[model samples]
Target: MQWIPDWGQARIESMVANRPDWCISRQRTWGVPMSLFVHKETQELHPRTLELMEEVAKRVEVDGIQAWWDLDSRDILGADADSYEKVPDTLDVWFDSGSTHSSVVDVRPEFAGHAADMYLEGSDQHRGWFMSSPDDLYRDEGQSALPPGTDPRLYRLMARAARCPSLSATPFLRRT
Candidate 1:
């Protein structure tokens, strides 16, 4: 990924190295559910977690996210239902935006299997989407999502333009 001012990548690297692990689940009553079953006693994912996720995905495709909330654990788990429970937490908002390459881009007919050529955003996202996307991609795909030598552009608002309101109509300034 390209950072226009060039230091953007370094800043993100430092943040990732120093930051604690991010939790990708939330307790919200609404949202895309994590959609997996876990062993009730061990608190570990069911051995068939992936298979269960696939079943949920099919239902979600046909019935939307409600499919997950409405699911009856017994229907899928049968006798195993006694030992496992569905994960109630929904995926954090970061999971949605951070995993767009897989959830959105990879599903498209034209963009499937291709990495994004560019990711353009304001400086504020450097700590949010900017860092989350690559981190998520690396975990999911085990490789860099952007091709080598792509433009590294980072555009930031000047101090007055970002914080101080002014009547002047001067264009926002940025460094090359």
Candidate 2:
């Protein structure tokens, strides 16, 4: 493929060696907001954070993504909630796209909790979605971060706006 470079394996190896912890926070309104409460002074997640996160996730599963938006901090954190501030930021685009392995593929009983046969996205995803998805998959499922499918397809983007005449440009352009 014209897109595949001769030194691709070397680049991949370097990325593996130098990659940093994925920061999944994004300052946007289009995704599932990270359901976290931070201490106003300590600047840390609430001590009971995991319990609160589970509650928020349950609400999301039952009432849709907006459940977090509708919830008052006190509703989940109780009276002491006033001491903490709910993070208004949404999840990073990478985390949002990377989760499809679970949300789309594994959720169906027919899929046997495995990855899909193919994943097609823009070239920009090599670092964003491609990287984020597996990181999230392994974290959540304890399986190798790599999905069973091949590396996602990538195309040359036009400089004007990074448009991929073949796919929606938002996933590529937004991240760039």
Candidate 3:
């Protein structure tokens, strides 16, 4: 919740400038419905039917979206059947991105314990995945980048010596 930015006036300007028309229609039958309604006589979608949609969403979480779809007119419009009919379009992109990690990685045990040695990206990554991946890695490892009680400066020096043993050798060894 704290992650959500309050854009306020900036949000309105951004929306006005970048608001491309979104195709709300989808051919899918699964997942959350678009929560619109069409008039039976006029064959046009009703604009004010989102009030009923909020009520339907509460029921969907408990009983599933199919329950709303299969409901009679009385239940669909909740006592206002003359004005509206439920929209059948559900978002296809919902399943596309929603289950990415689970669908791609978790099902294959080979990938389960594996991790990327390094992630190469443009400078944009400094603000994007690079910032987030470390937090995820730390959470997965159950500790910080260095183990508890280990000084990072000392660890780096040790690592450097480990990689270049000549630097760690004594001057007396030069005679040999």
Candidate 4:
């Protein structure tokens, strides 16, 4: 929510225009399920949905999202199965992009202990990857590599010394 840009808000008249729809349906079968059930007749979420979602999330945590795909409506909705339909949609592209840092840095070790030194891209990156990467970084950790309240001078010196093997010895002579 904090990611919304003031400039974009000023340009758009309605809230709907500013945010993308959460629709997850897709023609392909290679991602997380939308995790929603709709009324077969009304094509909307079934009543007592929040309870159902919590149950589904528990299963997802234990067995992964694929479990949702394998689940039967009767198991998830019980008596409502006759009236409701499962939505076959999955996650949005941005969700995957945004979660990379969490999945990579926090949950996975491929990017752990590594700091993103620079992000180079076209201007659109400000609204796309660049924006999402920082958000993901902060979500995993309260602050970034150079978080506030840390000494900038010391940080830079340490970073420089870390990269230079010869810095193991004192670089400058100290006059006693």
RMSD of each: 6.4, 6.2, 17.5, 11.9
Residue pairs with colliding backbones in model 4 are: 24-89, 24-90, 25-89
- The sequence of per-residue lDDT tens digits that candidate 3 reaches over residues 8-43 is 224434544564654535777676567777888787
Q: Candidate 4 overall Cα lDDT vs. reference? A: 0.56
lDDT of 2 at 16: 62
For model 3 the local lDDT of residue 130 reads 31
TM-score of 4: 0.50
Q: How well is each residue in 33-117 modelled by candidate 1, as lDDT tens digits?
A: 9998989999999998889899999999999989898899998889999999888999887667767666655466665555654
Q: What are the TM-scores, per candidate, against the unseen true structure?
A: 0.80, 0.68, 0.38, 0.50
Candidate 1, superposed: residue stretches over 4 Å from native: 139-142, 157-176
Give the per-residue lDDT digits (tens) of candidate 2, residues 1-176. 22344354455456767998877788887787888899988989899988999999999999999999999988888887878999999988777776765775445566554444334444555677766654655665586644554343334444644453565532221110
- What is the TM-score (0 to 1) of candidate 3? 0.38
Ranking by TM-score: 1, 2, 4, 3
lDDT of 4 by residue, 19-38 (tens): 56544346468787767888
Q: What RMSD does model 3 have?
A: 17.5
The deviation in Å at residue 147 for candidate 1 is: 3.4
On lDDT, the stronger of 1 and 2 is: 1
